[model samples]
Structure formats: structure tokens, C-alpha cells
Target: MDLIRDDDENNSISANPPEGYVEPGWPALYSALHQDPQYLYQPYAIWRFTLYWTLLFYGFVFLVTGLLLLLNFTKRHPRLALLSFALWILSSLLLGLISSTIVAYALAALYNAAFLRMSTWVPPLWGAVQVLLLIFSAAANVPFFTG
Candidate 1:
């Protein structure tokens, strides 16, 4: 994101760096991480492992959600099915990440509506559950991890 913004060819010639543009300060964070003796001596292999595992987990979730939509399964309820698909589409827009977290939360609102419409007490579908799970994952990463 910063690279795109920093490039004069991409941004307006008059564009100035965004707020808090201190070059040396950013590297200090990584340097601080290394200052910790535990992390300083650690091999890059462990970092690679964390990266791969994170990718695998997220990729599996995305693939499964998409496959559920691709197959005829979620179509059992047309409205909710399309709603679920729309949720995924919206995520692609990065409105959830850029605009606001509320965008991601709207999924739960839709889920509640679906539940209200459906007469059953059981969990209607995984749309709501998946959304919540994603929210949890995002929060956990944003707070402590480098996602």
C-alpha cells in the first residue's frame, strides 16, 4: 500500500507522503523484534513455517466457502445463498479492511435476519458462523500478529 502511494508515477506529482512518514522509525520495530534475544537467534525457517500455516488456514477457508457457493448446496435457500455469496464478493472489495470493520460485521446482521425469517431454532447456515470466525481471526491477527 505504501509503495503504491510512494510512487510518483502512480500518485499525483503533488502528493506528499501520508501522515507519520518517518522512515527510520519503521525499521526500529523490526530492530526491536531482533533485540529480543529469543527472536534474534531464531532461524528464518520458523518464520517461513508461520507464514505457510497462516496461508494454508486462510486459503482453506476461502476455498471451502467458495466451493460451497459453487456447488448446489447453499442454494437450498436462494435468498440466503445469494446473501452469502454477496458477503464473499464484498470482502473482495476490501471494504471490510479499508472502509471499516462494520462492513465485515454486516454479515452477522444478515444472518440474524435469516434466522428471523427461518422458523427453525437450529443454526440456519454457516454464513454467520463463518463471518464470526473471520472476525475473530482478523481481530487476533491485527492486535498482535503481522497480518
Candidate 2:
């Protein structure tokens, strides 16, 4: 079935807009009007990129656990093994969040430059949620330590 029908024209060549023609910007109430096309695509790209990182982090955790299991760390030096395992998880979580934030922002900037009229909410919103979670987790850990 033909989805995009151009009944009038024999040639299927789509007419290109003028060199600087900007598409209508997304009607995002919370977002400002983007100056460049790239801005429009940033939020969506960041959202997608962060999701990939999530999977990557999970895979990394699994790989670490597998390696640790093979080494039988839990069977010997149990306390040290537990400490190392906890540290590894904590470090990986922090590293993933930190790297995701940095890359998302950087790529969002690049997207903003390359695309027009894209929504700019998803990236910031997701990033905010992550930051909040990180803060909450850190706060919960504070009571266990003494200066």
C-alpha cells in the first residue's frame, strides 16, 4: 500500500525547502524556542543515549560479578570481597550517572545545532530525575559514617 501518495506528480522527487527554511518548532510549553535545528533533536537524543548507558551499566555489573565469582573471592577473604563488591557497585553507579550527564549534555548541544524545532524536555527531565536519585542515595549513606 502506498502511504505517501503524490498523485499529481509522476516523478517521486520531493521538493526541498529553501536552504535556511526552518520547520515549525515543537509546541513544548516548557521549552524555549530553539535558535538552531540541532537544539530540537537534543532532548530526544539524550533520552535515547542515557537509556543505552543504563543497559551498558547493567552489563558491566554482570561482567564484574561473573569475574568475581570465577575468582572465588567470596569463599576466601569474605570481608574484603564484600567491601570490594560494594565499592565496585557504588563506583559503577556514580561513574555511569556522571558519564551519562556529561555525554548527554554535550550531544544535546550537538543535536541542537543539527536539527530544528525539536523538543527539549526529555533530556533535562531525565537528567534531573537521575540527579535527584543520586542525591537521595548519597544522603541516605551519610548517617552511617562519622567524621
lDDT of each: 0.38, 0.51
Question: Per-residue alpha-carbon lDDT of model 1 for 1-147, expressed as tens digits?
Answer: 343223335432112223553222111223334553111111222223223333334445655766678566465777777777767665544432332233223433443333321111112122244446676777787846764
Best by TM-score: 2
| Cα error of candidate 1 at position 83, Å | 18
- Give the lDDT of residue 92 in candidate 2: 62
Instruction: Estimate the overall C-alpha local distance difference test score of candidate 1.
Output: 0.38
Best by lDDT: 2
What clash pairs does model 1 have? Answer: none
TM-score of each: 0.24, 0.42
Give the 10-residue window scoring lowest on summed lDDT in candidate 2.
8-17
Query: Which lDDT tens digits does candidate 2 get at residues 10-122?
Result: 42212222345343333322524555323233354454546454436444654566467546887777787777777766666666666576767665665445433334454
Query: For every model in order, what is the number of clashing pairs?
Result: 0, 9
